[model samples]
Target: MAGAGWAPPRLDEFILTEPLGSGTYATVYKAYRKRDTREVVAIKCVNKRSLNRASVENLLTEIEILKTIRHPNIVELKDFQWDSDHIYLIMEFCAGGDLSRFIRTRRMLPEKVARVFLQQLACALKFLHDRNISHLDLKPQNILLSSPENPQLKLADFGFAQYMSPWDEKHVLRGSPLYMAPEMVCRQHYDSRADLWSVGVILYEALFGKPPFASRSFAELEEKIRSDRAVETDLVVEAVRKDQEGDASAAFSLYRKALEYFVPALHYESDARRKEAIRAKVRQYISRAEELKVLVTSSNKNLLEKGNPARELLKEMAKDKPRLCAALEVASAAIAKEEEGRDDSDALELYQQSLGELLLLLAAEPAGRRRELLHAEIQTLMARAEYLKDQIKMREAQSMGKEALAESVRSGCTLQ
Candidate 1:
């Protein structure tokens, strides 16, 4: 629930303005400065007690990351202030709501428009990756475009970024589960490349009008990311060989989560302090022998996606990853038996359903020791459930769109 009225409404002397949007834990308000010509800004007021403890830590890391960044593509973090119970984070204000709404209204964005947005975003991400800072949350909601003197997209929200510079240890999982990488679905230390998977999700949404990994529930979503169902081509890639482990196997799930979260950190910051924190637990993406590192084509776009060898390397790791293998085997057997007409006692049904529900509740939890693994499992399950529900909805709406299009054509309107 959101706060009905502002708590201690007066902004510090430095800030000036009113609320922009309301969120459960934080309220983003449009603010301005008395002294500066550049007064267009957003002040986020957060209730300390309601936030996840890690979110606070991540907020501090965001400050550190922002202090070092001077990129045009990234949002400028103007200042920070704290007064007792509240923290005031002031950033450049974006009039445009978010990329999500922008794309949603237009349905499919033109390739040229997408190329422009992707270019700046990729450049900003490239900078973060090089600096060992992984913006783990790269969803459209975090990206703001401005129709200003200098119109452009500015990447915001560093809450989910991992600082690979200092103590990039294998901590609990972070970021929205929907945008998480396949490796992060299991438990593992992750790096900068995980940001790439997020970018991949955004791209998928750009093309399909929704996310590739989606769900009505959190557990079902996790199921989707954990399995091979998400292993699809954004651009065509020659299959070198299959990851011998079957889709049901969770062997490389941890490895997938690792690449999903961490590798994106390595693209920009080659700083050593961050390098020290990269952690041994961060499983490298699998590698295969005797293949071209990349191919250049219209789809491949100068072989950009292949440049990050992390995911491919993880595929090789599929053979050695064993943490979830046994559990997955057991779970798969249970499924098979149920499919083959094994009786499901009411108690058994209740237990299995409760287990899934509990996992999802845990996934929403940002606290806990094995947050990464727990979140992975929760998301995997949720993704699966979400997929089934979405399939049903799509089937129901399948003919409606066609009929509407036919009616429109009959009435003489352009198909688009």
Candidate 2:
């Protein structure tokens, strides 16, 4: 090692360039192969001096897990090497940088875009779960993006990972405090579901722009995690305050945000009676949220009716074709039902019925403005139908708890 400057050790196989990131134990550098192919990679260099017994164990576990796993959404470890001073891990290069930078650059991601990333991450987690591997340190900084344009998520950083099954439990604390489950933060026995709690945090950050327990100091964050009930109650009390003040929009948003934490809280609760009681409250909250959604939607119905020129255009274009016109009318009713926020299932069925007819008509029609307009209308209806499907699925998942929702996503049902 260079005494003071601590320059990365020279290697014969690759030309290391800029530093990608650094942590307590290692520094990752962007590098290119020195051979004919000149393939790019990220090389993690761990100083031998930094490896205490626990860290050495963690390093071995990381290598073992990365070497055995092969998934599109998880970073690939091509090879590793070591010298007197440092151990190096050569990994697949992701040009888009880590998710922490991605989120910071954008401030907050749109829900649709965030959901895509979440789906990819969920798929990767599902792969690990199947093999009984738990990525204990899951966070945006540890997740990579394939490239800037049309970026794909790649789960990276397995330094704290372990092969722990759902039934397996450990008392040793692991993972970032902000993203850690209450059990882990409180230094109690925790299982693989702790990773799921981290996932919920990631999802929340993606949608809302920051982790729920973010604080200026570690002590503040620990207090928030330890006083789980206080945190949960604060959100609910504030939401109720807003609801009483007639700020349905803000209240609705807060209620939804609270549910994100509430689900994980319910999952982490060990006592059967307490869990059942919390579940009942969650159900009550879900019911109230549904009512608020309808209230919010009904308040916006007139605005929806007034500005819907696109629907009018579709109706005008289908005037000559009575069947198409009838389908368009049915779609209009579906839109109204959706805007009313009552009977989402009815709205979905109506969309399906109209889409069936519109698609048949669209296929038979020639390539002209009418066909184009009709196709566009079909796309709009499909989006609405899909949104309704998601909403319905969310309500059902809330009833069953976080595991069911996460499992549904991981099973590729939502991905399709």
Candidate 3:
């Protein structure tokens, strides 16, 4: 080893431990701190040489978004460091890796696992919508599960998270081609509701084995987004309304199936059938939509809520994940720990668990005291989630190449 050692790449501050993944513009590697007991972390190395204006804008957006928000679902930005070769953004090492890998082989997760995932996700979404933050790019690729037991469904990659007030609509076409909403593709002014649209796409994927719009090629997929012409219940209602005029048998059946709840609102040529169908379908949708509610506010004020059942149905959902079978144990321990007078952090754990369950239901529910203030709680929880995410620490530099070999072993995976 030469004494000069060619100035030894400045980021010796963090010894490169293991490579998590490699993409066109960035490479993610697990690393550790050189000074602090060699603590472990993940480092995202973006080759500035290949970065263009759009990439730079995305990087800046990521930094800005991470700076402002924190939540259990959103990935945390630990620190920033650089060297002669490239820039490094250190973050919490989510041992489970990216959801892309999880979904790649399995296609879909089991309902129990999906329930745990959706619940936390809804809680985070409620938090973001309350604060007017819309995550435009919400897909499995951007979700990471760090702790299998108390798995944190961290919403990773925030290059597209934008702030939108209840009334403000963000007019931008950006996101993974597969998960992009119809309006977002059509250049329409959209707000929090757009997030709901994306949620619908995620829901479809969670329910079915593949994306509702999965295609063979990029161009073909984009065309579908531009003009799906599928049977959307809302579209059906407009077409079949007593006030409107449009008749096509196939589209009608498609709409009928899509709007399964609007049998009464959905009328045919016969007036007698119209009222009965409308009443039945409307009631059905109304009930189903209500079931989708993530939170319910009753005067009784019960805090601990259940998990989502739809996720429990996922064929590939994990069987050993602690949250599934040990809700009572986790809750009991949390309560005991919280009662010990630590910071009131348990404030939202129950909320996250229960909200996750409700979102899993996805049924139309009648408006009542339970969900009247749900919109506000969603916003409140978003803020709290952001805080917890930001508090995560970044490890210092250390020699990780040789050490990371052990991480390749897949078993008994638990967060250190």
Predicted model with the maximum lDDT: 2
TM-score against native, each model:
0.51, 0.58, 0.51
All candidates: CA RMSD (Å): 24.2, 9.5, 23.3
Please list the residue runs of candidate 3 whose C-alpha ends up more than 4 Å from where it truly belongs after superposition.
Answer: 1-10, 148-150, 217-219, 222-416
Candidate 1 per-residue lDDT over residues 98-124, each given as its tens digit:
888888987856667877888899999
Error of 3 at 398 (Å): 61
In order of listing, the candidates' clash counts read 54, 0, 59
Candidate 3 residue 56 C-alpha distance from true site, Å: 1.8
lDDT of each: 0.57, 0.82, 0.56
lDDT of 3: 0.56
* Better by lDDT, candidate 3 or 2: 2
| Candidate 3: tens digits of C-alpha lDDT, residues 1-416 | 22453222337678875577667778777788899688788788888897899888888778776777778777789887776668788888898776666655676566577777788889988987887777788887778878645567888777677777888866767777678776666567767677677776775576445676777766677687655243233344543452234223223333333343233123231343334344344444334323321122221113322222322332123244334334323433433443453544563465356445434332332465333333333333343333222211101001121122123223222223
RMSD of candidate 3 to the truth, in angstroms, is 23.3
Better of 1 and 2 by TM-score: 2
Q: How many Å off is the CA of 410 in candidate 3?
A: 54
Better of 1 and 2 by lDDT: 2
User: Local error of candidate 1 at 340, Å?
Assistant: 62
